[model samples]
Target: MSLTLRIILLIGSLISFYLCVKKIKQAKLKVENSITWMMGSFVLILMSIFDQAVQWLANKLGFMASVNFVFFIIIVFLLIQVFIDNIRLSTLNEKIKNLNHYIALKENSDEREKNVKE
Candidate 1:
């Protein structure tokens, strides 16, 4: 609600957005992964620039403090990010397991052919 806080949030969000872009340029982060960061920074900037929307939403949501609503949004976003990461990790693990199994089977068949030739 305070002007100082708003300025800080705006500056922080801008810095975050800039850094996210830099990472993308450097090929250190994929565009898909950076989407959440970009969106988060954009949301912070939006809430900072449009404080009235935050207040109205907080009122509608029955949150006495707008700050509480902000924190809730941040926590929920982070939780969703964590869930998505878990799903990605699970898929990667499954792919790795399948690859390893295929390699093992291939090696065994190759060994059998070699033995038959010998």
Candidate 2:
């Protein structure tokens, strides 16, 4: 690879690592999430280093190039993650709604009991 390309990849890898660390420190990302991000970034760095090897495999497999394959993989992973996140959020929302309903019912019952006592 060209010196420029190598330098750019190094910079990108460093930036990704730094961001992942910062997110973990700030509690913005859980440990598991940070680990996943770090692993993805590491894979990107490896792809950068072994680009030629990847290209050779791509060629053998009849794909266009390594870069294209990497992009496709990243897109698929992102879509799957988004789907999982949506499912988790929906479940959380349902739980919150159920809790709210339960609290309302309890309050109503308590009020009725107080009125009867008086």
Candidate 3:
């Protein structure tokens, strides 16, 4: 990677890491969710610092350029993060559905009991 790209990545990663922490501290982001962002930022920092390793890996992987490999890594990481988030959303949706059903059943039962009493 070029020096300019390396510097940009390094600064960007640090800023990302800092923002993640700030959000967590401010209670705007959950710690569990921020873990992925923190990890991703750390990986980017490592990659920025170790350009030689990145270049060698890119060559071995048949990438046309080290920057392409970096972009590929970032894209893959984001995809995985999105997939995991979808799984969590699905689970939450199921729980909400179950709760709503339970609430409806309880309300119905209460209404029926009131009618019988009257």
Candidate 4:
């Protein structure tokens, strides 16, 4: 491999390792999941460098010279999923805030009515 490819792989591996460690430390990811992520990252890095591997399969399966196509498609799909999840979370948050505000308003109105009656 060329020096540049070696450097890229090293950097990618380090980044993947760092992410796995961070996730584990934060309790956001289980050990198994972290390991999977780390392994996936390594594979992705390897695929990035040895693009011919993807091409060979693609050709065997009747895909064109667009080995990078699969990678980009996966990236776009993940990004869309992330965006959709973020939107859903934001909507739920807004609903919760509105419910809280409505409850507070109702409680205050009830108190006012009780005081007036007294």
Candidate 5:
């Protein structure tokens, strides 16, 4: 990795980490959701600090350049994050559907009892 790239990575990761913390402090972001951001920032920081290791790994992984490896890692991490979010959304949707069905049934049952009492 070039010195400039390493410096940029370091700065970017630091900024990302700072933003996550700021959002959490402002109650704009939940800690659970911020965990992935924090972890990703940490990984980038490590990569920036260990340029030699990044280069070696890139070579071993058959990437033409260490920068390409960094980008690949970032893309993969984002994909995983998106998958996790989708799973959470799916679960929430199922719960909402079940709750709506239960509510409809309760309303129907109540109406029948009211008619019987009348």
Candidate 6:
């Protein structure tokens, strides 16, 4: 990354990490869910701090530019996060449907029992 870009990323990462901590403290974000954000910001901070090492690795990996490599990593991580969220949402949806169905059945059974008694 260029010097300016590196500085910008470093600042951004630090701010992100700080915000993550604040969110956890406020109980706005759970520890488990904030772990990924914290880790990602740490990685960015490492990259910013060790610019030379990142450049070397990017060169070895055949990336024309270190910025591209950084962006690629960010995109890949985001995709993975999105996939995980999709799975979680699907599971929650299934649970909600099952619960609704069970409630409906219970209501129907109760109505039948009451009518029979009457």
Question: Clashes in each model (backbone N, CA, C under 3 Å)?
Answer: 0, 0, 0, 0, 0, 0
Q: lDDT of each model, Cα atoms only? A: 0.95, 0.78, 0.98, 0.71, 0.97, 0.93
> Residue by residue across 1-118, what tens digits does model 2's lDDT show?
4556656766787798899899889989888767766877787678778878767877788776565776776688678778978998999999999999999999999999999999
What is the lDDT, from 0 to 100, of the residue 55 in candidate 6? 92
Cα lDDT tens digits for candidate 5, 18-84: 9999999999999999999999999999999998999999999899999999999999999999999
lDDT for model 5 comes to: 0.97
Listed in order, each prediction's TM-score against the native is 0.92, 0.82, 0.93, 0.52, 0.88, 0.93
Q: What is the C-alpha RMSD of each candidate to the true structure, in Å?
A: 1.2, 2.3, 1.1, 4.7, 1.6, 1.1
lDDT of 3: 0.98
Pitting candidate 2 against candidate 6, the one with the higher TM-score is 6
Q: Against the hidden true structure, what lDDT does model 2 obtain? A: 0.78
| lDDT tens readout by residue for model 6, 15-91 | 99999999999999999988888999999999988999989999999999999989988898899889988998999
> Could you give candidate 3's per-residue lDDT for residues 34-106 as a string of tens digits?
9999999999999999999999999999999999999999999999999999999999999999999999999
> Which sections of candidate 3 miss by over 4 Å?
none
Segments of candidate 4 deviating more than 4 angstroms: 1-10, 27-43, 46-52, 60-67, 113-117
> How does candidate 6 fare on TM-score?
0.93
Candidate 1 scores a C-alpha RMSD against the true structure in Å of 1.2
- Using lDDT as the yardstick, the better of models 3 and 4 is 3
**lDDT score, candidate 1, position 38:** 98
